[model samples]
Target: MNQSRVTDFILTGFPGLHQEYYGLVSFVLFLVYFVTVVANVTVFFLFATNRSLHKPMYYIILNVSACDLLFSTTTLPKIISRYWFQSGRISFNGCFVQMYFVHYLGSVNSFIFLLMALDRYCAICHPLRYTTIIKKCTIHILSVTAWIVGIGAPLALVIRAYPLPYCGSNVINHCFCDHIGITVLACTDRSPYSFTAFVGAMLTLLGPLAFIVFSYGSIFVEISKVADPKSCVKSLSTCSTQLIIISLYYVPRCFVYLASQVGITFSAGLRIVIIMLYSLVPPMINPLIYCLRAKDIRQCLIKQFYITTGRQKAQVFAVSN
Candidate 1:
């Protein structure tokens, strides 16, 4: 690991691994990718085509789906190509471009979750003003802000931290240009720079985490005052989902960052698996979670399906007549 090394990460990715393991990994990854894409696209369709789902929650859901799509797009193709074709070589600029999208959008994902907490808090605590407060413009502006801040903030930090050093080899353990992995390749001693990046990561992670915790805490207090039976249960369920999502995203992230900083050596496969979990696992399950808990989205999906079916039936009947 030389500090003055700069080429690009020559990834074996997944395809170039043990021949026997390639099939299994490819099948699983492809299946996960398929399911995530279908589910997210379905969510997007339901949100955009149907006028009924134009609510604040679904707006955030749309933003998340977009992020997940980008996240999956950033990682899966590389891994798939790596395994099936043994083509894992990426250029220096390509790696940075990939890193740019991954970091910027991953940051966006975190920020949107924070926005979701605030949306929930507003919907729950200030029911009368919910509609007026979380308007379309509000969601649009906030989402765009997430993208800008997420990408711009990390870029500034990287410019300052990475002094453009070049070392020896460019083998990346996993499929992607992992934040710390690339940082270690710089020729300079990365302690000062990495510490700054670590602090920045913690800051990015903490902002959303604190917002979620506080918003939910306040939501619970407000919930206790509500008398409606159905409303109380619904509020709790949504809040619970938020907590689960937060835990899923931040836990492995914390481990990856903390352990890397402390010099904990992780096996390559396990390390890749851990990083991929944030990108892979939660995305596959998010639609199901949202559908199961979200009465509004569920109804909208059902309604859309029925309408499509009904239109098909009407066309057939007319043709026969």
Candidate 2:
């Protein structure tokens, strides 16, 4: 028996979605893409313009914003086009490229989250040494290292899956090209590759999550011992916000991976929905949770708004004269 190689893969946005809802789905995805880009860009602008935000914590936030922006750009446009313009087909090389960034930036985010947890732990647990430990230089180095590590970690996945003989079924059931989604379409038995990807995914997801839990646990304990009520409340509020963002990113992802590994059954549509929620929601809301809520960023935004508004009024007065 002979088989022909698959040169392109068709992305099925949602397996069960009807044509009638394509417009609505595309509109929603367009909205998400728009928000994700704008929100992350705002973070970039803030970090670049405001020298006051050039600290270790804000550096980590900047890294996260970049990752979010890149990840959304990689995955969302193709899928949105799939639903909107009815162009869901991606070339083999293009699919692999998408798969690489989807996992690469995701790993970068996980590492950044770990850095954030470490930052907070030091600030709350070891305040005296926090400044010394997590300095601008230190974070810059760590963040650079994270990006480097992120690049190599997901390369293995692409390398392993890319050469596999994909002879049949070029349709990907999900919105984008991911390791599991692409590998399953291979003609060979995908069990080994799937298992390898699963192990890699778990390690990527769980390693940082465990540390985040420990860091926050310690922070909570420290907060309890603080005598000042105001300080305790402020500390709790900060940690709680971080935890919410963390949960949004990690929990659904872990569940999806675990379910697949354990032979649990779920609808393809449901799985895609869960994946979208975990992938897109955090980036959209991160600006609100991390940037806008911060006192410095809020004040800076207000100050900028007024300055821009005053400039516009002055221009109008000049034109009137």
Candidate 3:
């Protein structure tokens, strides 16, 4: 076995897509990245500026938006660079860092979604104790727990793969450095690490997903017990937007994992495209879904807009006087 370590890995990028499309793809991806950052930033600023929006639910939403922002910042710029400048080379250390963050932030997202579901469950299912249960201190603790577990879990996986030398090939078939993508390049037998990765992936994704499903399921049951139709609809409306975002995040990911495990083959290009769709689409739309659908955020944004416009009008009147 070759012991020479690979210094850098070249991303394979889209397999069959012609060079003529690179510009278009990069442009579109850039647009998505820009929108994702702006939307998340808007939410973060809104939460910071508006004390009225400082409830536990909105705080959790703010954390999710922040995670989405960091997730995109960590992964997208490199991908855009790959297409825009034809620069796909990433150092071994750099690749591992990217791989770590990609999975770490992903785990953080999953946990945050779980927390959001729990918050909703408390708010709706046990409305009487919701405030006492999910207090501000509890929110802070939960947020910290998500970050710690997110970083620690992925760090373990990355460390497990770290000692394996990558002497076989320096080309990663996917756009970004991911655990599976990097593990496949190992000089040693990949079964152990691959299995570890697969299991870890399932635990990280499905564990939180299971909790979310159960929480929502219970919430639904609780909603059914409500005698007033108007109250029931109002409760469902509060959760509907989150459910949509949760579905967007988990469903495609489950499909991809199931397809791969079942020996259903996808072309490299097709698989990467699908992966990108699932990964990028959620971050781009998460903030929008919440801001547009959630009543508090919408109200906050509307207030902000009017405040800004009113200030501008006052300045203009003062200058005229």
Candidate 4:
């Protein structure tokens, strides 16, 4: 076999940064993973352990946290492991699976969060009709639908990309086998792929933005009904939280995925801008959003801390005995 027929790719991290940053980068990444996992797990557990959080809003909140939890899990660890351990090499099959997880989980976060915004819109805007409209059955069906769209939309891409023979350098340029990375491997031409990528981007990115804008648009109209100045001001806080998180999540995504399609240069800065938007902002800021705007989650966190401390003291007493 000629050297040109080799079947693997190398990822050189940080085009501009020092190689020693691998260890430091990995350490920092691990710390972020730890915090993200802990924060979401606490949200999950808080929802699980408390009965008051069983409301539709909290259920949506817990699921949002769960989505972010899965979101971070899908990509961050592999990034850390790859940079530090030189264990970054992935088999073709492994790469496809990673791609699917990243794709689907990201889609799930978007749709699930769109539903959350809708949930808030209904609850605050139509308090009298909220319970009847968004019942448990509705919650279950909506959640299932979000997950299905997330997982299903990318099936065509996976089937198309995987079957084609990779007759050239298999090295994935990025840390992951992103759609474009894998698409580049197709020995065959990919003109028809444009439609599929466009649809997927619309479904996962643009579609959610449309829903968010529509929901918030209606929400503001309802909030405007509050003649009380203080309540109107208070109402803006919730909307602002959702808007901030949405911008942070969507701006870079639109830049890298959607805007790049429009011939914008996808330089390193664009990639870094996106990384902060999706990877950093959503996980770290979402918990803050819930804490600031959500009364129940804040209370749940408070109760969880006392309960955990009480259990710790009880364990100490038992050990002393």
Candidate 5:
């Protein structure tokens, strides 16, 4: 067993996928990455530039879009490089940096979702006091707090992994440098790191999850109190998109985590594919969901496009005249 401080890591992105299919896989991943970037960036721009979207609800969405963009950019480019250019080697410092961002951005996203749920709960459950409860200052404070906690939580994990001896294998089984993937390569007793990671991962996933569930539960109770069926329907509709988005983000992650815990065996490639689905699918679909399902965003986009087209036609007519 070669034991020295490992300087670089070779990523086995898709271990089970045959070499003959790497080209096709890489091409498909490129398409997904392209769409993920474009879609998330479009929504982020809409949120930033549109004055009408300057509310707490949309503010949280803007945060989510930013997180998704960072998340995808952090994880996907390396994977794409691995498959497309056969460039899978990442330096030691680079690996930790990537791991930090990967976990940090993910934690930030979870907190944002928790904030979104609280926003909806306030909007529906305490309509009279919603504005008072979620003022601009409050939103700013909460947003800042979320970012701090998200980035801070992962810093500890990185510090723990940094001092460990990595004289074992330099090859990381997964595409990205997660706590689990990187720590496993350490030659020392990784139990403490593993335990710390488990606790952190649970807090990251389950803590927000518990809050979201409580919020929606309370939301449902409030919705049930409405006398008019149409009013009830209208109130519930506001939350449907959030519900769908939460399900998309959390369910597959929970499934993957639980499956691994219970020793439900999955092939290396299958596990990587599952993780990719949870990671890539949310960013790809989140913007689409908002654009398709949220009337205001969709209308704004359509109206913006129409105005641009009309201006182009007017320019053409002016030139001809």
Candidate 6:
């Protein structure tokens, strides 16, 4: 069978979306990209400048921030341009590259969340050995391992999907290139590739989620045994921020992925909305949810703010004199 392979793919930002709403949608996406970049960059800046934040937990946070930043950058810009300038076309190879980073960063996030859960569990459950167990070297090793695994896992999917005969449609229903969105466009039988992707996605999402659940379960049990109400409240508060971020990241994603796998029918627009929410919102608010509220980070930001203000005032006085 002779077929003309497509060399480009068109990304439909939102199927059935009106041309009139393009500006509005593009503006909204730009805002999300802007905020996510600024917030995660601020996190990087804080971590770099503050020596006191050089600990295991904050190191995990640093990894998370970097992952979130890269993920948002990988996805948001092209979609924004799609809506804003009516430019939705991506080269075949470029699309595959984007797909790789999207999945890779997302998998890295899942592992980072597991690392966070482990950190909390140790701090609450084994205070005496927490420092010894989760050292800087250990975090470095684990984080490097996460990056390697995350990179390797998605490469398989891309390799399998990229060579498939894409002789039919060149339109991707989703905003970005992903395994499902890309593989479904191929003319050949996709069951093998789909099943492979399904299993990989499940492992990437569920494996870490299971560990996180166990870690937090143990944390709650330990917290309950504490006699002092103040100590209990503090422990719960510390865990709450992480819980909220984790829920935002994992719940909607699991829902979307499972819904698609199970043949649950839904509108493309609604699915895209859900995907955007889960993908963009967590990174945008992570700094606010975790870093800004942290006592040490807050102190560092305040101290820096005052110093900058003082320097400005001193410069003004010198100019006047």
Model 3 over residues 97-143: C-alpha lDDT tens digits?
99999999999989988988998999998889988999988998999
Per-residue lDDT of 1-321 in model 4, one digit per residue for the tens? 533433555544444556777789888878888888887787777777888888776677677787788768777777788777967777777778777877787788788779878887887788799889988779878998988877777777787777766778776666566677777766778767757877786878878889888888888898888899898878777666667767777776766675666887767745754554466557866887777667877887887789889999999999999
Which residue ranges in model 2 land beyond 4 Å of their true spot?
258-264
Task: Give per-residue CA lDDT, model 2, range 68-105, as digits (tens).
Answer: 99899999999999999999999999999999999999
User: Which candidate leads the pack in lDDT?
Assistant: 6
The TM-score values for the models, in the order shown, are: 0.87, 0.96, 0.96, 0.88, 0.96, 0.96
Q: In order, how many clashes per candidate?
A: 9, 0, 0, 1, 1, 0
Model 6 misplacement above 4 A:
258-264
Q: Write the per-residue lDDT of candidate 5 for residues 17-72, one digit (tens) a residue.
A: 78888788889888888998999888977876788878788788888888888888
Task: Report lDDT (CA) for all predictions.
Answer: 0.79, 0.88, 0.90, 0.75, 0.89, 0.91
Residue 147 Cα positional deviation in candidate 4, in Å, after optimal superposition = 0.8
lDDT of 3: 0.90
Instruction: Give candidate 1's error at residue 57 in angstroms.
Output: 1.5
Q: What are the RMSDs of all candidates, in order?
A: 3.2, 1.5, 1.5, 2.8, 1.5, 1.4
lDDT, candidate 1, 1-321, per-residue tens = 324456667876642367878767777888888999999999998887878888777888888889888788887888777766767788887777776677777789899999889898888888799889988899999988888788766786557534557576677766787566666666667787767776767677888888888988899999988899898887788766666766788788877877977999878777777777776888888888777767788888888889999999999999999
- What TM value does model 4 have? 0.88
How many clashes in candidate 5?
1
Give the TM-score comparing model 5 with the true structure, all chains together. Answer: 0.96
lDDT computed for candidate 2:
0.88
lDDT of 3 at 32: 96
